[model samples]
Target: PKRKTVEKHGRDLRDIIGQQQGKRALEIAAAGNHNLLFLGPPGTGKTMLASRLCDLLPEMSDEEAMETASVASLTQSEINEHNWKSRPFRSPHHSSSMAALVGGGSVPRPGEISLAHNGLLFLDEMPELDRKVLDSLREPLESGEIIISRAQGKTRFPARFQLVGALNPSPTGYYEGNQARTNPQAILRYLGRLSGPLLDRFD
Candidate 1:
C-alpha cells in the first residue's frame, strides 16, 4: 500500500511586524531548545511569535521522528511524510484538566506535552490556567519525560519539548503606565496563578 502524505504549513516569522525583541527571543529559544514565556498585553502578537518557533527549528532527525511517531501512533493520530520530519506544535486550552495536559486514562495515553516531543508546546493565556495544572508541568519539563502510574503499571512518555507560554501582563490586559486598568494588587493576584517554580523553568 502506498503511504499517504500531507503538507504541513506554519506561520512565518517574517509575517509578524515589529516585535524585534520577541522575534529575537524566539530565535534564541529555537536555537537552544529553551523554554520561553511572553508577557504582554493582548494584540501584541505573542501567539503569532510563538507559532513561528517551530518554523525556526531544524528538521527532526530519524530517531526523533520515530520517537514522535510512536507517541502519535499510541494516540491514533495521523502521521504522514510531510510531518514525519517536522517538529510538532501543541496548544491546549487553559481549562484543560491535569490528566488531559499531562496524559491520563485507564489505559494511559500521551498528553499534549508527550505529543509535542522533539518539538514545541505553546501555552497561550498562561496565567489563566489553573495553578496546579501549570505546576504539574514542572517535573516533566526538567526530566524530559512523564511517568503516568496506573494500577497495572507505569507508562513513560517522552516530553522533551520546548515550552512557549504567552500571557497578558494584567487581568484586564493593560498594565503599562496610565493605560493600566487594574490595581497592582489585582495584577499580582492574576499573575500569581503561575507559580515561582514554573516560571523558573523558562529562560
Candidate 2:
C-alpha cells in the first residue's frame, strides 16, 4: 500500500536540536538564502542539527524537488522514495576534490556540491581538503550554479546551497595555556588556506 502524506506543522529544528546559535544560523539559511560555516570543536552535534534542517523546512516546490532530485540521482545514494519530502543535505569528506565537490568526471557527473543544490552542503573538516579544491567552492558559492565548461560544450547545474563548514582550530586540535607551546605561524598558515577573496564571499 502507498504511504500517506501527513501534514507537519513545521516543528522548529531549534526546539529539536537545542543549539540556540546553530539554530539561528539554520534559520538564516532558511530565510535569507545564505550559506553558513559552523566553527567549533568536534562532538558539537553540528551534523545532527544540519540534518534536521530538512524536516523543519517548508516543503520543496515541485520544480525544486525535481532539480533537487536530479542531483541526488548522480550519486549512488538511493534517495528516499520520499526524497522530495524536503531539501537535500549532502556531506562529503575533507578529501573531496574540486571535481568531486564541484562536479566532473569522464562521463561528467554531479559532485557533492551539486548534489546539495537547493539544499545544504555540510562540509566536515573543512581545512583538510585540498586548498585548490576548497578554493573552487568560491565560484559555486557565489553563482549558485556551476558551469561545467567542457569540449562537448557547457553544462550548468544548480548549486545554490547553504554551505556549513566545520574545522579544527589546529592540526592537533587543541588550545595551549601560557606554558604550553602553541604555533602562531601554523594558525596563520591554516587560516590562510581560505584565501581572502574566497573568505569574502561567505556569510
Best by lDDT: 1
lDDT by residue for model 1 (54-139), tens: 98988889999999999999988788665689998899998999888999999899899999999999999998888888998999
On the 0 to 100 scale, the lDDT of residue 1 in model 2 is: 100
Model 2 score (lDDT): 0.74
TM-score of each: 0.91, 0.83
CA shift of 2, model 1, Å: 25
| Residue 173 in candidate 2, Cα distance off native in Å | 1.9
Cα lDDT of model 2 by residue, 1-203, tens digit: 99988665434564664588888787877777666666655667677676766665667788888887777776776666644556777888888778888988766788888888777788877778888888888888888888888888888888887777776666555555543255889876876787787667667
Point out the worst 10-residue segment of candidate 2 by lDDT. 173-182
In TM-score terms, candidate 2 sits at: 0.83
The Cα local distance difference test for each model comes to: 0.89, 0.74
Superpose all Cα atoms of candidate 2 onto the true structure and report the RMSD in Å to 1 decimal.
3.8
